[model samples]
Target chain A: DVKVTQSSRYLVKRTGEKVFLECVQDMDHENMFWYRQDPGLGLRLIYFSYDVKMKEKGDIPEGYSVSREKKERFSLILESASTNQTSMYLCASSPGQGVVGELFFGEGSRLTVL
Target chain B: GESVGLHLPTLSVQEGDNSIINCAYSNSASDYFIWYKQESGKGPQFIIDIRSNMDKRQGQRVTVLLNKTVKHLSLQIAATQPGDSAVYFCADGNQGGKLIFGQGTELSVKP
Candidate 1:
């Protein structure tokens, strides 16, 4: 089974604070994604990485950035958290070889910005 | 503008009954479809997937039907149990590896 582990299950941060969420995949998948889930809007893509040192902006990437410094790890950075940034963060990974968007997700990190 | 949407936001069913969740996609270029289940305080889990070439696919207690003509997708759950109560999302994907997910439908099972 594919295991995508998240660094924090729950986090509370003050407004204007920088936040970091880490994810690691044991399957060594080449494609990693960061998404934020909210009510009604569903899971909106924030960023995705196809390989180390490579990243692409998703639909909603204004307040976020990502780093794939290693094959097994991808990190999402919130430059400065705001109240609107409070949401559930999900990390997912898939094989870059031939897979077509079939992703295995982490347990998720719930972020609360005060 | 590519978008995926669900016809119903919520669906209620009794235990041991069958449940159907529907979704519609606007992009004809999409060639892949997937269904995901998300429980409270958890990430979405992959339930099933189908390609454009196939019209129907079945899993353990689930079946996926695709209608390319209408650009529609449906997930059918058999013998719906309390465990099946969760938010379900349908996603449209292509060979390029981009996925557009629907808003999701919340399923509730009553005993």
Candidate 2:
């Protein structure tokens, strides 16, 4: 069984506070992704990394950034959190050599911005 | 424009009955499609997948039907149970290495 672990399950931040969400995968997957899931919008990709130090913007990349300093670890950062940024964040990883888009996802981190 | 969308936002069915969820895609280049189930407070889980070469595929109690003519996709669940209640999303794996997901349809099962 592959495990994608998220560092935080719940978080609360002020409107201007900086936020960080960390994720790690044990499967040596080369592809990692950050997505925000909302009630009506479903899951919108914020950023994705195919290799360490390499990042690409997804559909919704504004107000967010990502870092992949190590192969197994990918982090999502909110420079200045806002009330509209409050949502469930999900981290996912997939093998670079396997099926194109079969992703293994973490349990998700719920963030609330006041 | 590339978009994957659902026909319905919610579906309710009685336990032990069959349930169907529908999805539509606008990109013709999309060859691979997937269905995912997301429970409350959890990330989406892959339920089934189908390639463009084939129109129908089946899992344990789930079946996926694809219609390229209309760019339509459907998931059918047999003998639906309470445990099957969740939000279902369809995704297209045609954009290079990324997947574009739909809005998702919430399924509720009545006991």
List TM-scores for all candidates, in order. Answer: 0.97, 0.98
lDDT of 1 by residue, A35-65 (tens): 9999899889899888889998889999899
Write model 1 residue lDDT over B3-89, tens digit each, in one string.
999999999999999999999999898888999999987888999999999999999999999999999999999999999999999
Q: Rate the local accuracy (lDDT) of all candidates.
A: 0.92, 0.94
Chain A TM-score for each candidate, in the given order?
Answer: 0.96, 0.97
Best-performing candidate as measured by DockQ: 1
- Model 2, backbone clash pairs (residues 3+ apart or across chains), number: 0
What TM-score should be assigned to candidate 2? 0.98
Candidate 1 C-alpha error for residue B44, in Å? 1.2
What clash pairs does model 2 have? none
Please give the distance, in angstroms, between residue B102's alpha carbon in candidate 1 and its true position after superposition: 0.6
| i-RMS of candidate 1 | 1.6
